[model samples]
Target chain A: MTVRSGAAARSGARGRPGAGGRPGGVARLVVRTVSEVCVTAGTLIVLFVVYVLFWTGVRADSAMDGEIGKLQDQWSTGPVAAGTPGATGGQPSGPGKQPPYENGKSFAVMYIPRFGADWSKPVLEGTAVDVLKKGLGHYGRTARLGETGNFAVAGHRRTYGDPFKDFPRLRPGDAVVLTDGTTWFTYRIDRRPYRTLPTDIGVIDPVPRESGYSGPGRYLTLTTCEPEWGHSHRLIAWAHLDSTQPVERGRPSALTG
Target chain B: MYGWIWRHLPGNAWVKALVSLVLVLAIVYVLFQYVFPWAEPLLPFNDVTVDRGMGAVR
Candidate 1:
């Protein structure tokens, strides 16, 4: 009877029949638990570290972009702010006259409500590492809204974890919204894909050889690598600026809420 | 991490060591899969930290 009782106690302790005969079970469990914790902590730490590092670059770039926008706004409104007519300070009045670069922390994300989880990643800037990882970057040289040329923004397609993983799936009539809380700009996809090398200037030509554009029309050329995995060709999506409004007012009607 | 667990788990040690390693890995996996997401928002590496300023006052 004593031997049977001992066997039962051992099994109960290990939760496996006859397992209590194993020595130091509790201690082993504790050690295993600690090791598991260490592994998990290490993984989380690595992920967090990478996220933080890139986040700083993202914030800085956003802030700098905001600053540039403020400066441009001041310059643009300076003449009006001073109540002067044609206060053009000998500066050209078109895309060529505008500053080649802008800085501002204010950026609005344009999401295609139509796309589901397929369009989850945020737009980041530049094809470069620092910018592509965070948020989309407006081409430093592209024209601004209400302008007469192809203003462009380029981003990575596959590398750096592919923020634009599904950009290739974009179809005609996708809506893009740019915002700074106070102002929101809506653009509609009017143009389809155009392939070119990064250095191909003709791809960004204000007027394509085939398409005739007249008057001052706002345009957007979103460029990324062609195909999903390779950079042999550049993929360009063209859109015309539809309207500009305050973000507080919500999305434009063309975007269908 | 599974990698870490696989690395640290005993191949040469007795059952005691292997059990110990397994327990540790389970704890870590729990912390990673369940706790890490919540903790992420509070970590020091957060881009949007508590301080609202860009280290400069207006």
Candidate 2:
């Protein structure tokens, strides 16, 4: 043991000349510094993963619930508060003509029966990162809720509350329902989940190119990451407006049933 | 590295340990509140849009 220790000490000293002339001084310092940096980096990565996987979901879920609660409060009252004009007690004229939705503002609540009975999420106006962290985001360019053109929305498939965690489970003839406080819009899925490149912006077009959609209609485009936890591609689902009912009537059959 | 931090800490053994823990906790809080939230969007997992721009805020 002593001989081996002596040999190691001598070798370490020879590894760095003029390094304090102390045995194993420079080599040990270099190794220690490298290892310490690596350990620190490894720990930071773990912490970041924890933040993305668990912390973001926790905060996002509460944020979504808060948005829903506030929208409900607005509904219980008469007209929606300012910043959301044209939120009337009367019937909607149709898509393409309505008050402009405030950016980062939640204007509706969405539900998919295929996801789960209790599943619900707020639909925000813009598809900003901050907005999506709270709830699903409406593509600014698409049609409004239940509008004639495509009303597209985006959501995280894995993190940020996992609004689209069950997106793949969506199949043809499934129902996607939404209520903008004044009206209940029920949209029926037209096809199964379609996987495409992220660059395929046509998926959210007025009549999505590959959704088997032939012409313009009251379409709904739902987009999320392709893989469960990665973003190498996009998963899309298209739906057509099936029916509409005034909020005063009650929840839509798609929800109650 | 931890030993260096412990040596530099101006306190008794227990106080030093407590300070170290507090420092770590403080760092984690900052990361969670500001750093992680900002850096998260810069990463790819949050990309749900159909646009091709990687980590695009759009």
DockQ of candidate 1 against the true complex: 0.04
Per-residue C-alpha lDDT of model 1 across residues B1-58, encoded as one tens digit per residue: 4445556765655765778777868966676455644554453222211111321231
The alpha-carbon lDDT assigned to residue A214 of candidate 2 equals: 83
Instruction: Point out the worst 10-residue segment of candidate 1 chain A by lDDT.
Output: A81-90
TM-score of 1: 0.48
Q: Chain A of candidate 2: what's the TM-score?
A: 0.84
lDDT of each: 0.52, 0.84
Q: Give the alpha carbon lDDT tens digit for every residue of A151-237 in model 1.
A: 566655543344455666666677766543345566677655655554564545565322234544567777676655554556677
Model 1 lDDT, residue A63, Cα: 45
lDDT of 1: 0.52
